[model samples]
Target: MNARPGSFGRFVADADAAGNLVVQPRMGFCAPHHMRTGLALTKAAAATTAGTLTIDSYTRVGDLAAARTALGEGAPLNGYPIAAHPAACTRALLDGVVDDTFPVQVRHGSSHPEPIIRALSAAGLDATEGGPVSYCLPYGRTPLDVSVDNWSRGCELLASLMPDGRIAHVESFGGCMLGQMCPPALLVALSLLEGLYFTQHGIRSVSLSYAQQTDTAQDEEAVRALRRLAAEFLPPDVDWHVVLYTYMGVYPASEAGARELLSASARLAVRAEAQRLIVKTAAEAHRIPTIEENVRALQTAARAASTARPAAIAPGGSKGTGDEYTQARTLIEATLELSPDTGRALRAAFARGHLDVPYCLHPDNAGRSRSFIDSTGRLRWSATGAMPVPPAPTSAGRTSVSARELLDAVHYVARRYDAAPAD
Candidate 1:
């Protein structure tokens, strides 16, 4: 199936050119009417915004029958069931809302996204996000090799849409793996690798993601590293951008804290020159946010971004090369040298402990990597496993992070934010 040309990539590029931070909500609904309403509201929001149709879990795991039964029973779903819903239904839902100014991306956490891609393409949508490693490691027990193949197939399917005028844009979720506490270097490395994988499969436009970490300066360095790496590695023709995911870790219980944290993310995006921001609402600590809540969050982020200083002079214009950039470059270059085929290289990287995600317990992951929040709030590696990156400067010759320490590190952001003064 071929998609019509509604360029989500172009829209974001336009926003970046205008120095506007494109804020997007992780919003979804099971019912078509509600979903349509959400998109409409998002498009009408008082900010430069994009739309999202996050796929439901049942459809993500390929359980279409269960999704259908829930639909028939009028049961609410955590997200939109894109695969189970008719293509025509999705088309209708997207019809009036998604356009040049407000492009929509289907956010589905599926290792095997062929069906989802096919359905969205048929419905005239041309953007989505996920990665072979990102979608596989955290979501389920799918083997890394199988997940790699599935994403390869999915990218090929998206590429097939190009002959008819659509250039599908895919965003890499690799940077947000395990949501928090992973060092910025590995996050940046994974995102660049996945973007390369997408390009290797013929995707012409892509976005590399990075989640906001503990320190603002550290996060800025990571985003700069991402842009620098993308420039050095990705093909010249690939239209690419950086996307910042608002702190994906534990949310603050207080509304003020959540809003403050969200505003902080918006500022980070501006300072770091990210083209888009995936926002989290004040209700993040409680439950799924309503349309009003999402809109409020978008507005808040936009306001915050407007007050921020734009990214420094040029891409990678920051001072000396930081450890994050050095480590990420080493990881990416090492992986690329492993095999001409990116998928095989990724599989081999994990197998050889060259690629390891901290706190990720997937069967394929090398569990030796460990990280902790340093005293300065920067995420520092406690252990680097067999990865070629250098040892953490703060390791103090200690080789491991205790379980209780790990628990505290996981909730560090939430606790700090919650205890902060009201805005």
Candidate 2:
């Protein structure tokens, strides 16, 4: 397990250095054979790819007894219950499928992931993604302070695995908070904050994520902003990369529209120099895609990416500055000054309304901030709340968004894409 060619972070770094944009799927299955087949198909895809083992909801919510009961009853669960299944069984699933060229990461949305980490470790896996705030606020009523303590201990546990020769990599889910229309600057700030929190808790390898937003130019600026903030704030010794998720909000009902949106995301990843992309299938608006559908989506994204040219930024680096950069940096520095401990600082930031999510209803969130999609398709804050950053020029005169406007903003991308012809 000692840092090898197969380490998740190292593999991505090497691929980025070689100018290959890595694409991955949010795929998992209940049956061992099915999960193994899914991973094998992902690795064999026509893209520079990675594998994911998404955990079931029961396990994510710490309902292991229910997970076990479903297993015993032969009822199909939504994803692999790593905590409920035997370690040996997981090992068998990954035995020959994972290699130096292919690395697998467990994706579970959990505020309390210590047990999941322990389970993954026993099966000889190390990389996983989630955050104290990101996983807590969006999914349930878990208190922010409690989630912070849980993640602090969980990160330490994952870091301890490094001594066994495995490279422990953690990706912060902070950037994808509330799925859509939250404004890019706040998303960027949260992602960087969570990345800093992971480093404080002992994770040396990390990745910051940003989801594609309403406008391509705005999305590009947000990704570059994230990279710049990482350079300014992360420990120099920490290994890190940028990952872009396909638009996480409403998907277009038209297959053609969905394909266009997915393609647009791949192009954005290339322009922003993101090392990896988490793709969504055309089936996203309907149901869980079949393995064959996932493979097709991976290949489609790969083709779109190959036709793209990297932005003027240097390979593996970015130096662009925009409004997003200024705002995100201001928020991050303000939060860091609150306390030496990142976990405590995050809790304080939220408690004081310094870090507020636009539509998030978590008990910890201030819930005072609001965002809207402007006529130009850029996400702007309609209310800055108590945050340190000022509202952008487009939002200067706006103090409120009507319920009808909010619904339209959420469906903005979908309607636009669906209206255009696929060809």
Candidate 3:
């Protein structure tokens, strides 16, 4: 989308096509408890502040019936209206679960928009000129493999689908940890490259979806680093939105507790001047969140934003941001200059299990038992067949899994090849 300068309020106003404002709610980071409770809070906030609330319903990860239940139960309590996407709304439409259905504009895969647009038109929900509908794309971090060839194909696909420019806003899918691995320089380059493409096209609004981490000491540092990187990469010229989620991966015990944690995190984000804040519920660690959880989390985030104030600028201001950008640039330059060395080092690290690259969520190691040691020295896995799925902890705690364990697993699997008498 074309990047433009606008306030959150302005963006909301511009996004509406039904002559009414709608707030799109999503929660994919926190535990389910937080999401359920948060939806209740969001409805209350919208009622008190905005004209009226129309929920953009879709589960980031959950069951639909339970979500509908939470919405039905909570909407009345908060005195606001709710809406569901086509998928969930389809069932609700048939069973009379909701008042109306809002279809989500989706690109089938990687920027190809034609099929989706055609489908929307065929379904008679084409609000291209000024529809109340909004588009959602399941965009993860630009995959490591997003080469020029892929980019060209993606651009061509989008161009074909959106010839008339009917889409109002685009919401990217799935939370990612960009700052954890991508250096600031790389972020700037990538942003510049992608930003140019998006701006060249007619796309107007975009939101960054980031997986949330707890505000522990280590996490706080990570957040600070990430914030600095964002400052460097996020152009002030374009309208920007940020979605922060709580770590449901670790804390999935209670929804209420998760909400509390998310609220605290939202407060932190507000201080940082994040345009939009989303709090994920705690239930996501084990299962997909029901619609109720999604609504609850959105509700809680809305409430939190209502009372939040901007925080004072940190000591470094944009200095840290600039430095990270410079460092990233240097790294990229070095990599280009020493591709052979860099590749060898990267492969070596991968082989040793010292570095866990993105997309390689699982890896195997040989000859050594595996265990993850937490900050408190607790080991979670050993001799991996399938790692134990620990119960979601109530408090933020750490557990370490050793690289050796992965190596052992790799070795065990490789033995079959080794024993196969020379092929």
Candidate 4:
């Protein structure tokens, strides 16, 4: 994989340079043929696309023993176990489908990602997504320090592989903390922090991520904030882009409802000036989406991107994005001042309450931070806790999160889309 511009990161960069929105599916399958077919469908879908090999849970948790057991027993694991799959099979899945036009990224939520990274590297892949804090705090009990060390090695391996045109692209999952409910400022701060970490560890190309949040306007501001911060802090040599995830919260139970929400996410991506999108399917609310469902989502989002208008981005230090830009930067500066090393600073930041996530149950998390939906449906920090949230208009009508309020906030998108008059 001596990519001189052949890497997935470059592929998306070219699309963005052409002002195209690159859409992708969160697709994975246990079978080689199924995974290959998914990539083929994603590549052939009527959209600017990329391929994804989202690894299964067992592999994600580093339970390769169980992954092997499941594979041997033919248990229906949700995703392809790249770390355990025969390298030939995994490589075969992408042989022709993963060319210059159709680059692929391996997505796995692993705190211990070395084996996964090694396997992907062996299969000639250089692009993937995850981060120390983002993948650890929200998903599991993995120690933050341990995850940082593992990712440090993982990033070095990827960066070391930058021979030829193979640029290592690492997308930070930080911005989508808890998928929803966390304030955009914290999300942006974390994502930027992760990008900086990647750069520090040697990844040259990184995609700062922001999930589509509650209010469309708020999300636009969040993306704007993300882009601005990346431009300001990220080194130019570390080529960076932005990727938006569809609403990662509770999905609408109805197909019509789910499609509506998916379209909304695509529009969110385009309007926010994001270059890439991670799409979810109508079957998301029910079960794992089939490849056809994923392809349909890709098409729907591509169509949405085509018709979407550009978002109005307010200038920095202003309330254009509800002061999220200012607040997120504040967090980053505070964290960087912790220590010279990115990993140590991240660990110290979490330990010292300089960085916090709302509603996250991990032990390393400072569970004090709390967020709630405002009357306008924008996610607002009800209690900024230790992280600083500069005064912003979005915080004016912040509702207190009771059990009922929390439930409604979680279902915000689903209810709105499901209640829409069906087509």
Query: What are the per-residue Cα lDDT tens digits for candidate 3 across 1-423?
Result: 233323232443343222222334442222223323443444444322111122223221213354456665654212111122243332232222111232222222232233333433333322211010001112233222222233334333443454353333333322332222211222233232233233234434444434444223323333344444445554454443443434423443445555666666665554544444434554544465555655556566656655766545567564224343443344333332433333232233224433222212323222222333333422223222211122223244423333674344333312322343331
Whole-model lDDT for model 3 versus the true structure? 0.35
Local distance difference test, per candidate? 0.90, 0.91, 0.35, 0.86
Model 2: per-residue Cα lDDT at residue 161: 65
Give the per-residue lDDT of model 2 (tens digit) for 1-423: 112444688899888888899999999899999999999999999899999999999999999999999999999999999999999999999999988799899999999899899999989888999999999998899999999999999999998966455678999999999899889998999999999999999988899999999999999999988988888889888888999999999999999999999999999999988889999999999999999999999999999999998778558754658889999988998898899999989999999999999888898999999988887889988888899987655535768889999999999999999999768
Error of 4 at 36 (Å): 0.5
> Distance (Å) between predicted and true CA of 45, model 1?
0.7
lDDT of 1 by residue, 157-234 (tens): 898975465688999999999999899999999999999999999898999999999999899999989988988888
After superposition, the stretches of candidate 1 with alpha carbons farther than 4 Å from their true spots are 1-6, 311-320
Give me the runs in candidate 3 sitting further than 4 Å from their true place: 1-156, 159-204, 214-238, 314-316, 319-423
**What would the per-residue lDDT of candidate 4 be over residues 14-111, giving only the tens digit for each residue?**
89778789999998899999999999989999999999999999999999999999999999998989988988888887898888888889999999
Question: Model 3 Cα displacement at 345 (Å)?
Answer: 19
Clashes of each: 0, 3, 45, 3
lDDT of 3 at 315: 72
Candidates in order, TM-scores: namely 0.96, 0.97, 0.47, 0.95
In angstroms, give how far residue 161 of model 2 lies from its true place.
Answer: 2.5
